[model samples]
Target: MKHKVILVVLDGLNDGVARHAMGHLQAYAAAGRAALYTLTCELPALSRPLYECILTGVAPIDSGIVHNNVSRLSHQRSVFHYAREAGLSTAAAAYHWVSELYNRSPFVISRDRHTEAPDFPIQYGHFYWNDHYPDSHLFADAEHLRVKHSPDFLLVHPMNIDDAGHKHGLDSAQYRNSARSADILLADYLQGWLDAGYQVLVTADHGMNNDRSHNGLLEEERQVPLFVLGDAFSFNPDVEPRQTELCGTVCALLGVAHDKPVCRDLLRPAV
Candidate 1:
């Protein structure tokens, strides 16, 4: 049977300390229903490039989206691309950078903020412009999209953790609290998504350092958490998945054919 997918990317959430802060996610990971892994982010550990990386399953060096400032519509086919091609609906309640990558370049808020164009890669989109946009609100927006569109592939990205990391160092209470707050927010909606038959993938693009910056080789900046919650995943994974494999994995769960590489080790035999 084909499964629907909801990919929730908590931008810039790290592997070590922040992991402890996300109580709801950790509980889900421990309950035996979800498979957890530590994903190694691609080089240049920046947001925009890694966003493209996670959605396109292509490395920065190869995609030429190596820098965050390189703003334009993606040239590579993404998970949304393949899902739409297979006659599946796709939607996103994410940051504007996502809109810039998939919907249009140099995002114009008036025209692109609340989009419902069937032809776009992200067919139904609700994009936020500022990093300060509340994670709680983003999740609500995602829920709205889910109820209204019932999209086959949904991308729900929240930026509060990353915004806090940039404003304060990773060691600060602010950063930790931001993660904790996100955990509380997830507690309100995750089970509903899963109960509704949406296989969930919660992960991060990259991590933040104590120095309050990324785009470096520090372990803290390179490693992030990946949690796959659904029957589609192997309950106990034996291999670490790369960030680039996300697109393919989502495609695989949605039964959409794609040319990208998937993290097959994480998948169950029936999937």
Candidate 2:
């Protein structure tokens, strides 16, 4: 049977610092079912550029997304395009910008609400202008989309931790608490996906600096945590991975073709 995947992007989730802040994520790593890697993202370490890199396996310079404020993406082929060509259902429960990127592909069900809402379902797919929303509501919307649409490829981008980082600084207790909260929410949904036999990729687009800001060349802002779990990831744990490889990894697991040479299948049998 073909495998399905859920790619969860915990924005600004770091490695060494995150383990100290996110207890649930640390516990999940300790369980031995997941392979943890410190992957390096594109330069400037901003969300939009890093996200474009992950989706297209293209560097920021070539993708022309060095700035985060860019409202539209270039017409480059992304993972969504490849998945659609392979006849797979896709869904994204993320920021409003994500929906704007693809302009709502018929094969993709994108639910995004930039602002906080009294309830989540009410704002599905509508532009919400603001970029802040409760993580609880975001998770609920993701779960609802997963159950209702049952998309083969699901992307969940949670931004509260990043918000906390920017608001309270990376070292503040509020930031740690936000990371922990996101870990708990992820753990809940991860188990559901595992029970249903779906491969999972938990990672971050970028990390935050001590000053709680990003979009710089600092290692603290570039090195993000990557956790690959599920039966499909039953391979040696000693291998190092790069953020660019994830597009191919997801395509491989979902049985699709990816033309980008920058990405390699980390799960391929050891040569």
Candidate 3:
């Protein structure tokens, strides 16, 4: 049976904040819908580098995306490319930078007004600069495209928690509030996917420190929360996985081929 996969990336979603501030996430874990894992992200723990690692299954040093200012992936082989090669429709709803990475893919729904796909009728959501829109809009746009296009792979990046963490320290009440809000939105998305029988994978690009800044080598900055909600993943809750492994895991779940020899399938043999 072919399974549709939805990977939701809550940017800067850390274990500490999810355990304390996010009640919905805790409930999901308790109900067996979530398999919690501490995923060690790439060095520097920056968003772009971690994202490149997650998508390409390569290290930051090798991918050459150690900083946010760097544009585009040095390597061309990514989950998106693999999915497309397998004849599976791919769609991504993320920030402007993410859209830039998958520029003109016709499946990138982002806040950038300039990116367009004249061939497709999909109305990609666009938000203004300096004024952020709610994550619900992005999710809704993804859902619309999913229902209409029946995309085999869908990637959603929600930035509320990350933004809040950046503006206010991780210890601040504002950060907690943003986490709770993100948790609520995530719950809704998870329920829809579960009801539709789609494989759901939730993870973060990186984590934040107490000061709310990342791009460091601290444990707190490197450790991210990964929640897999599907029978395909029989992960051991105690076993922490590297973020790079996710690319292969997603490929295996979707029955797509990947070229990452170092990436092992975490779901095989029931751990």
- Judging by TM-score against the true structure, name the best candidate: 1
Instruction: Please write out the lDDT profile of model 3 over residues 1-271, one tens digit for every residue.
Output: 4567888888887777777777876787798767777777888788878777887788888887788888753454777777777777777677666654554332233435433342321123332223145777767767766676667787888787888888876777877788788888777767777778678888899877788699878877778888777766665665657787887778777787777643344474532
Between prediction 1 and prediction 2, which has the larger lDDT? Answer: 1
lDDT-superior candidate, 1 or 3:
1
Best by lDDT: 1
Which ten residues in a row are the worst by lDDT in model 1?
17-26
Per-residue lDDT of candidate 1, residues 198-254 (tens digit): 999999999999899999899999999998898888866687788888999899999
Summarize candidate 2's per-residue lDDT along 41-150 as a digit string, tens digits: 88868988888888777778888877777767456777677777777777777876666565542222233343222222112332323446788878887887778767
Name the TM-score of candidate 1: 0.98
Q: Give the RMSD in angstroms, all C-alphas superposed, for model 3.
A: 3.6
The regions of model 3 sitting more than 4 angstroms off are 104-131, 261-265, 268-271
What lDDT does model 3 reach?
0.71
Candidates in descending lDDT order: 1, 2, 3
Worst 10 residues of 2 by lDDT: 114-123
Q: After the best TM-score superposition of candidate 1, give how far the Cα of residue 171 lies from its true spot, in angstroms.
A: 0.8
- Clashing pairs for model 2 are none
